[model samples]
Target: MADTEFVIEPGRQDLVMIRMFDAPPDVVFRAITDPELIPRWWGPHVLTTRVDRMEVRPGGRWRYVNVDAHGREWAFSGVYHAVVPPERYVRTWEFEGAPEEVALETVTLTEVDGRTRYVAQSVHPSVEARDAIVRADGPRGGRESMDRLAVLLGTVADM
Candidate 1:
């Protein structure tokens, strides 16, 4: 890919954005940072993800332990940079699998037509890094997670 490919925005922030859900703002926010809820939707549809920790407050830490289809385990972790209740959050992320990688993530929640409009913005050290992540987890894994989150919200809706 070209450098312009991952030039998501003209600033140091808002490098990547993806939206794919129909839940409420609060519910979507919780699904992104809550430890108990992450495990249910934070992986490729074919893999099982396990959450070791997810502390949603500033300076807190979160860890993801994922198991591939063949029962392989990989870990990822990060510390929260900023945590704005029901609206915004920023964090530093690192994946402990393959050649290690790190990125900064910022998420904002908005209300669209009375439903949640969740946007996830991820920034990497460089465009090269961004392309690498896309190659690794692309083909809409994030979209799949968002889909899973919608399902989770549906499950909660009826309860």
Candidate 2:
């Protein structure tokens, strides 16, 4: 299993995550941007994710909701700022529960020895906001999500 490395510096408003995938960059990129594949690996294994809306293009908007076994829901929405296929994408992410605390996120995919190196950086409005997310078990959720994605990529690459 690939481990997700998180970089959280003191007093910093940004969080960086790095992970390696066994699939090629294009395969990894498609798994992330394709709405059909998103639900398969978007969040924690216990939660079922639904992509309400997703338009993978510049200026497009996207939204997804994750429902737990107890019927609880967590909704997240974002707008794409830049969309470069098989390479990188920039977007703004906001969780509905925390209305105005938005984070500008950049996801980059690089080819490393025929595999993909995934790097994501999320910049929050303030250091406090970033810290709040960390306190909310964000890193654990992220790690789980990436782990799920890695599994999906293995199946996807086989196809």
Candidate 3:
């Protein structure tokens, strides 16, 4: 598995994450957009994820909740702005705990030598907002999620 790289530039309100998967774009895309498969690899290993709502089309809404061992839940919700299967999608992301700090996120998957290169760009409302996420170890969570996704892709690559 390739490392999940995060690009955070100074004075910028956006962050970009890149990772490579040993699977085709279609397979990778399916693994990401399929609600049934999401809970399998959507968050940290210690948390159980549940897809409360997922409508994978333009103007559709999606929500996911992660529950810890102690039964504490963290929810995230978003609305899809654009959707192109196996290629890209743009959406808004907001943690229910801090709804005011919504961010616009664009995810793109590119084919590279038969593998998939996944890139996600998240634009926050301000530099402070972006910095806050960094301070909160958002990248670490993202890395863990991607690591899980990679493992899932390996299992479902032939499906």
Winning model by lDDT: 3
Model 2: per-residue lDDT, tens digit, 93-141? 9999997899999999999899899999999999999999999999998
Return the lDDT, model 2, position 135.
98
Ranking by TM-score: 3, 2, 1
How displaced is residue 98 in candidate 2, in Å? 0.7
Roughly what TM-score does model 2 have, to 2 decimal places? 0.97
Give residue 110's lDDT in candidate 2 (0 to 100). 95
lDDT tens per residue, model 3, 1-159: 389999999999999999999999999999999999999998888899999999999999999999999999999999999999989999999989999999999999999999999999999999999999999989988999999999999988684
Q: How close is candidate 1 to the true structure, as a TM-score?
A: 0.83
Over 6-80, each residue of candidate 1 has an lDDT whose tens digit, in order, gives: 335443433565564566677777777777778888877887899888888899998888788788887888999
Clash-forming residue pairs, model 1 = none
TM-score of each: 0.83, 0.97, 0.98
Per-residue error at 6 for model 3, in Å? Answer: 0.4
Where does candidate 3 stray beyond 4 Å?
A: none
Instruction: Please state the error at residue 1 of candidate 3 in Å.
Output: 7.4
